[model samples]
Target: MTQMTRALMTAIGATLDLGCDAIPSPGPGEVLIRVAVCGVCHSDVHIVDGDWGAPPMMPLIPGHEVVGEVIGLGAGVTAPAIGTTVGVAWNGGACGHCRACLEGEETICAQSEGTGYSRPGGYADHIVARAAFVVVLPRDIDAARFAPVLCAGVTTYRGLKRAALKPGAHVAIIGCGGLGQMAVQYCRAMGFRPIAVDLDPGKLELATRLGAVATVQADETDVPQKLRDIAGEAGLRAAVVVAPAPSAFTQAIAAISPGGAVIFIALPAKTRDYLPISISDMANHEKRLIGSNVGTRVDLLEAVELALTAGILADIETLPLQNANEALDRLRQGRVPGRLVLTMA
Candidate 1:
């Protein structure tokens, strides 16, 4: 590896620039990963575009879904030995004293620090991650595919768990993008009938190929009634909304059955602008509206286990680290088909 590492920075005012910086040493309770691949996710775009209000940490190395080998460890580090492969996710570190963390909701800890947002992330050749926040993985797993399991996998998995759908129940996955695609696969793995709903024909087709029992073209068909018809006696047990659009949430809600849940995983830039919920409908049906952030360490373990055991992975394309800005631009413009992975080599 180069002495001066390469990093992509989200510069002031949301512009991205690449530069060389001195490699950082791990702090106490931290581990330094020799980053093999960094999975570029929509959340990075949001951070670059100033979507989550002000930047949590300015001029950031914006990447969170990280997979690499542990080459260095800080004081008190034991497991995830040097040369071991691991993944760093969205939640970088959390304050264990917070109520949320105490209750095992580390993802929602008041002092939770985001990987790319609050600290340097895997856009570089080497990144320092909190040992408690990283996931130990098998050395032989596919780097490109497993990298996405750090973020997209765990997020959707937590969304499914929020739904609490029973086996053989009918579930709806809204939007067939990176997150939605994984949601459909997980839905099928959990023994549920996955009904994929998407505006794009290509995305819907991909969802079908990924084990969705049925598909709904959002631009053409009626979402609620079509879902109800397909669900039959199961009556739409749960709905996982992975689209960043406001309409997706409403459609997911419309498709849900009595006592079912709508688990929201996407954070649309204008999400607060236009969300229409019916109090009467929610009350009458006993439906739930749940918002899921990234997952905890326990959740990450389960997600990776599922990914390793069930052949679940993202459809990936690779880019050199130098093209990080271009990759972010393409993602923002909706040009990339699936997840875009950045290679540190």
Candidate 2:
């Protein structure tokens, strides 16, 4: 086996060099994985453009939705076999002793290490990951197809799970992008009446194909009123805002019926500290607004299983790792019709 691993490095703004190499060795409780497919996420753009918190060590490797096979295990790592297929998600590892980790919410751990942002992520041909943070993939699913579930699918899945909706409840999904598409499928599988809202008619059409019961184009006048009409008649239970538009939150708040919850899953390019909804509205209507980040390890596993069971696979355009820059450009320009994934040979 070759000792050197080839990786794509973001040397600076929008520039990637393909010659970077790393010889990674797993430490105690960690493993080295030979990456098969790494799903490109919107978060990568934030990291590359320095829009997110801070750049992860300059010349960073960014890719978190990774599906690979364990090639070597570090000392004290006993769960995954050498050839076991696993996924490395956004949450690379967390300090198990933290209060959040202790409560089974390690995704919010203060010391949690993010896969691409905080550490060397999956853009490389191989990566070192904490064994505990990896989820073993099922043998029945194609590895490439399962890649996006690690982040996008799991994020939407966790949002719905947190919503705590009962069967037959009206659930609205705003934005039919990668995450919103997954949300529609999961909501349908969970027996919720899935309603999709988006400005793009193509995306709405895709959402319908993915099992959404209704579609609302944001360009329509009185869109929120239409959502409210639907929710009021059907008894709205919750809404998940997968769209990053700050204005969408206000529309979601208006559409949700009394006691309905709205979960914001997207991180906008810029932060808006406050929503347009007044405190009185929340209190009087008994409405709840919550924010969810990428999911936990357990959520990743469940997301994979749900995707496999419901055939809720992501519609992706696969590109070679060499074309990563092109893929990122397309994603940044909003030209990508679906998720873009990078494949490694």
Best candidate, TM-score? 1
Q: Candidate 2 clashing pairs?
A: none
The 10-residue segment with the lowest total lDDT in model 1: 4-13
Q: Each prediction's Cα lDDT score?
A: 0.86, 0.84
Model 2: per-residue Cα lDDT over 106-129, one tens digit each: 988998888888888887789899
RMSD of 1: 1.4
**Per-residue lDDT of 1-345 in model 1, one digit per residue for the tens?**
446455555454455667788778888999988899999999888887777766678678889999999999999998778999899999899999888989999988888999998988888898999998889888898999888889999998988887777889898888888888888888877678899988788888889899999998888568889999999986998888888788889988888899999998888776565787999999999999988898998889988888888899898889989888888889888886778999986
Indicate which candidate wins on lDDT: 1
Candidate 1 lDDT (Cα, 0 to 1) = 0.86
TM-score of each: 0.97, 0.95
Clashing pairs in 1: none
